[model samples]
Target: MRVRMTGLAGVIAIAALLVGAAPASAAPGDASAYGARLDVTLLGNPAVHAEPFAAANANGPTQNTFVGVDLPGILKTGVINASASRDDKSGGVYSRASTADVRVDLLSKVTGKISAELVEAECAATQKGLVGKSKLAGVNLGKLGQVNADPAPNTVLNVELAGIKIAEVIFNEQYKNNDGSLTVNAIHVKLLQGKLGSLGTGDVILSSATCGPAGLPIPMASGAGLWIGLGLLGVVAAPVAFVALRRRAALNAA
Candidate 1:
């Protein structure tokens, strides 16, 4: 008996194999497997709260209880490992061990949701208590889009502040968890002096702040490169395999 397969069938088989080998997209919270953090600066005196532990603690996770915040103008080592450019005179390089997704929630009647990539987060005790702050200077608002207000998701808040820096942004002790990582509860955004779209700005205030759940771990660069190489090889080999198989079948039949 001769074994035979058509060109189309061979192509499909190869495609199936590649798809099976590919990894699933990292979901929210997958990135925070090690830990997570959130930093926010608001323009209001309103008090807010968040329950970041609620999701992990609903069933009680085995993760440790360590938390911190990132403040502006502070030189933290090895926190943000992206293509961030810093003009520090000391000349130090920062490399991240891994990246994670982090969410911040503004707990109040009217809420505001904010989140950022947890590329670098350091939690430690201070005279005031635990303070963790990360650098968020180069973040592109276009990627983040207009900040949305809760309940009325359609209402996207607009800010026209140029060279905007998430300054004076520090995570205070209000955020705490006994069995999990710290989640940002509330933030106070002081206008300092800026404009809010049409609302001519002298003083802008934030009612509450909130964060979405953490996202999954980003794909490893090495792994992705390997998969690409394999996929290309499969594409080139599929046609050759089909032709060879067809010739073999014809020879056997003859």
Candidate 2:
């Protein structure tokens, strides 16, 4: 039995499977949501809200959640695993997980929706948490424009900042789950045409910060990379600048 959580056209279907199916009339707090069983290789308890729960109480859900993102600098990529209960009476966990989705409006030229799809699923029998892998899927953003952006690939909120095309800005990729943890992937941008410059479509891990929270999931300064990179750049530039100045001054005096 599979419960189907259908999204707008092209949206990934979140279906209840193998365990059994339920009607769509089930309520969130209904008792049936706690019982339907799934075909688990390593059966752990389906996700239940433990004590010390948040006011939202949204760890795993039966209803779909909406997420908004700031793109690029905020988050590049990540994945999310979720189970929804289909049994209105049995109201149990949806056997498989569904990837989150997003809609892109090409301002003027293009507009469509893109959804996230699970690439893999491995829920630990003892831990009860399923780890699912995903990629940017259902990406059909219509026709390509003069810029060469796939539109289907991920793009950022704004195309031009500081007169930079920021072709590889993927905003929807930046996510926030019901809770406020953040995740950032990578960024790529190259200049192209027009007063604003042409752009290309970009991609990212949707479940990351894009599906999660407003606050950052991890701290930025946690790594030594930033400090080292800055130090190296300064060290390499200082000597060259000093030597060039000295040579120029000596030649002028001569």
Candidate 3:
């Protein structure tokens, strides 16, 4: 009886070990989004500077608006609206950023003005794959030709003033982070020249979003069902082994 009980105990222990050895799904990732970031200098002096607006993450959404902005005749905008939001789904994460009614007076004398009715950026990560996209609507660059509504990744448009390239307007900028995350910027403006005649160099970004890598797929039978099935098998097998041992001992005694 003692030997049979020991053997049954071993079988149950093995069953428990099998259940514990099952693979576990990876942890879910995070997401973030923001709108309208400006870091520019005017006349060799740090004049116009503002952090990203309406930044949001898994915690909650954010929104803001400005009636008008005048950067001492260097930059100007009218009725700017920005918003950002993030969502965590079952097996993935999603983030979005949007802006509307944005107008920038880029060296009015040299380059007329740039305006966009709407700009948006989106990012999502799931078991299937990572997806990112940017949209520009009703955009007009005074001298620079028409803006591409659906530009490819990291598309750059040279900003030429008086036949001399001064800046670059990058659209749909995408970056693959080291930690398996992705960042997407709807529009990014980088000043190539050190000085725009008298205005200093700087960069501006609008409608940006980022999301971590996709979560691993969950196993079909990895949860409670797996443990229950293993437990039942052990219970039945243990009793059967005990009964068989008892019968054998009785026959040997007889």
Local distance difference test scores for all models: 0.31, 0.27, 0.70
Candidate 2 per-residue lDDT over residues 138-234, each given as its tens digit: 4433332212222223344444445654333342232323443222221222223343434333223222211111112122232443354445446
Best by lDDT: 3
Q: Please name the candidate that would achieve the greatest TM-score relative to the true structure.
A: 3
Using all chains and alpha carbons, the TM-scores for the candidates as numbered come to 0.23, 0.22, 0.68
**Ten contiguous residues with the weakest lDDT in model 3:** 80-89
lDDT of 3 by residue, 72-152 (tens): 554444544444333323457777777777676654555577878888888888767778999999998787667689878
In order, how many clashes per candidate? 22, 28, 0
Which ten residues in a row are the worst by lDDT in model 1?
84-93
lDDT of 3 at 222: 52
User: Where is model 1 more than 4 Å wrong at Cα?
Assistant: 1-5, 25-29, 33-50, 53-243, 246-253
TM-score, cand. 3: 0.68
